[model samples]
Target: MAILVTGGAGYIGSHIVRAFRLAGLDPVVVDDLSSGHREFVPDDVPLIELNIVRTKKLTEALRDHSIEAVVHLAGFKYAGVSVQRPLHTYQQNVQGTVSLLRAMAEHDIDKIVFSSSAAVYGTPDVDLVTERTATHPESPYGESKLVGEWVIAAQGRATGLRHTSLRYFNVVGSATDELYDSSPHNLFPLVIRALTEGHRPKIFGDDYPTPDGTCVRDYVHVADLADAHVVATQKLLAGQELEPVYNLGSGDGVSVRQIMTAVARATGIDFEPVVAPRRPGDPARIVASGQLAARDLSWTMRHTLDEMVESAWNARHQS
Candidate 1:
């Protein structure tokens, strides 16, 4: 039996695939490579360059590899972009998730680990967001993710399929020396792209309620996030009590300027930032208390902001 990962060629999915390989498990990859790079997957891991929406091809891949469980990471994620193309986002994220679940059911492969997001919890009245926080997503992207989680929950409850939804904030940094960091949407690489290339990074929305008046977000390293996936899988494989939702984050929130400062310190480029208006539907603060993950999965973030930025910088420019 093998583990099949959708979007395995993408940033987070690739790292998770790396973790699975490191843990002595082979993962079959199915990615259309729309945004994911083909080079992300290793030579040994078989890659099926197919979209999840294509039910016929997906089912064949599952049966061919004897797939036991799936890590669903195939979806678009950009708040502003989603707002512009809400219809496209819904069809891709929501419809695609539903199709994957149905395909898994048909193939008799039930176990699944979903890659959820903190965006599900919009700017709540509560500063620190927990899993119990009302999922009042302001953007279509968040709503699509929430819907995806619901699909997993409803399917798991209805069927014998066991599922764990890992809802966390931004995915940062790379594991190992492969220099696995590159996404236009993520801030770290964008900042590094600007600084190393002698351009000023733009800080969107400078006057938020945060201390630095930018946006504050829960940043978790990619390796730590991958570790949680492995631990979560082990828990389910060991027949441990199932947790519907467990967050993965550094408990501490990092602001925009704070990140820039770290970048400046690490790269020795104390450059002025270009400030811009905030994107619509952006939350002022988002911090996570990953105690539940710590208790259950023995998961903890091992990398600091400096480590994250420094490593990301090295990966983007150095490598």
Candidate 2:
């Protein structure tokens, strides 16, 4: 049975596809190509170009590919933009998840690995966020992801579906030259683009009460994140006990100023970042401990900050 990777043409999804193949598992891709690049998927892998919101096509693909489980990664993932487009965000993240769940239920594909987000913690006051943190989401994107979790949990309760959601922090770096983070809203891309375009990268606010007076966020390597997903899927398939949710985070976080410095060092572009006012709803610090994930999913920050920056820079230039 093949593993269905929704949004497999995307950055993280593409990496997961490669990881699955490396583990000797067949992976069938389903992507709409909205933000994903077709070239990212391997030529040998079967790519089904369709939106997950289309229940009929999704169900057909699931059955046709003999999919045993799904890695759900297709969704509108911009949190700040989601605030302005709440309905669209809900329709894509929440309703799209509902459609996927319906198809999974119809086809008797009872196992799923959901791609959740750390945004659900909204501006946490805690020093280190854990799975037990209160989920007071601040944006429609976060709320929709939280709702997606609830949808999966509810399905599990009603239909005995085996499921687990992986809440990702600020994901960066690349595992391969063929794939890189392409999200326009992501910091790595933004910095790389700015340097390539000969523009000074802008830092939101540098006056926050952090050690460097900038916001601190957990930045995990993309390869590390992908490895956790593969391990989680393996555990579910083997019917091993697993947590309903796990956080893939770096125990120690890097500050925005630190990121700027790293980018300069990696790209060999030394230019002062334009200090702009802090964006509304920006938190001073939000880091998480991946102890639980480490214990169960073989999660670890295998790449150092310098390694992450260098890999991302090289990939960006290669692309």
Candidate 3:
């Protein structure tokens, strides 16, 4: 039985697809290509170019591919921008998720791994967030994701659907040069683009209470995150008991200043990052404990900060 990866042509989704393939699993892709690149998907994999919002077509594809599971990663995922485009965010994330769940039920595909976000926690009050952190999403994007989790839980309770949602902080680095992150809003891409254009990268704030006086946030390597997804899929298929949600995080986080230094070291760009006022609603720090995922999904930080910067820089330059 094959796994259906919605938005499998996108950055993180593409990485998960490659991980599945490397693990000798068949992964069928269905993407609308809204922000996904067709080239990211391997030529051998079946690519069904359809939107998950199209429930009928989505269900048809699941049945046609004989799919037994799904990895749902298709959604509009920009928290700040979601403030301006709330309707779009809700439609793509909430409505689209509902449609996907309905399709799964219709096709009797009960296993799934959802790509959720740390945004669901908003500005967490504690130093380290856990799976039990109170969800008080500050933006439409985050609210949509939390709502998506609820929808999945509701379906699981009613239909015996086995599901898990992986909530992650900043996802960085690349497994392959050809599959680098292309999100316009991601910090790595933004920094890399600025440096490549001979512009100074900007740091939003440096007066936070952290030791470095900058915001400290978890930044996990994309490959590590993909591996967790693969493991989660395997566990579900084997009927292993699992948590409804897991945070794939860096228990210790890196500060923005540290990231700037890493960028300079990796790209050989020697310029101080310009400091700006913190964006509204920006948290001072948000790190998560990944002990649960580590025990269950073999999660670990395999890349150093330097490695993450180097890999991202190399891919940015290569692309």
Worst 10 residues of 3 by lDDT: 59-68
**Per-residue lDDT over 208-272 for candidate 3, one digit per residue giving the tens place of the 0 to 100 score:** 99999998999999999999999999999999989999999989989999999999999887989
Q: What is the lDDT of candidate 1?
A: 0.85
RMSD to the native, candidate 3? 0.8
lDDT against the true structure, per candidate, is 0.85, 0.92, 0.93
Candidate ordering by TM-score (highest first): 3, 2, 1
Off by over 4 Å in 2: none
lDDT of 1 by residue, 1-319 (tens): 4788898998889898998988887788999999888988899899999888888777776777878788899988786689899998898889889889888988888788988888888787887777787888878998999999888899987997898999979888877546466777789888888877889999999999889899998898998998888878767766777689988867789999999899889888879899999977677888988988899888897998999877777766645
**Order of all candidates by lDDT, from best down to worst?**
3, 2, 1
Q: How many pairs in model 3 have backbone atoms within 3 A of each other, for residues 3 or more apart or on separate chains, i.e. clashes?
A: 0
lDDT score, candidate 2: 0.92
What tens-digit string does per-residue lDDT give for candidate 2 at 65-157?
788989999999899899899999999999899999999888888899999999999988899999999999999999999999999999999
Q: Could you tell me the TM-score of candidate 1?
A: 0.95
Clashes of 2: 0
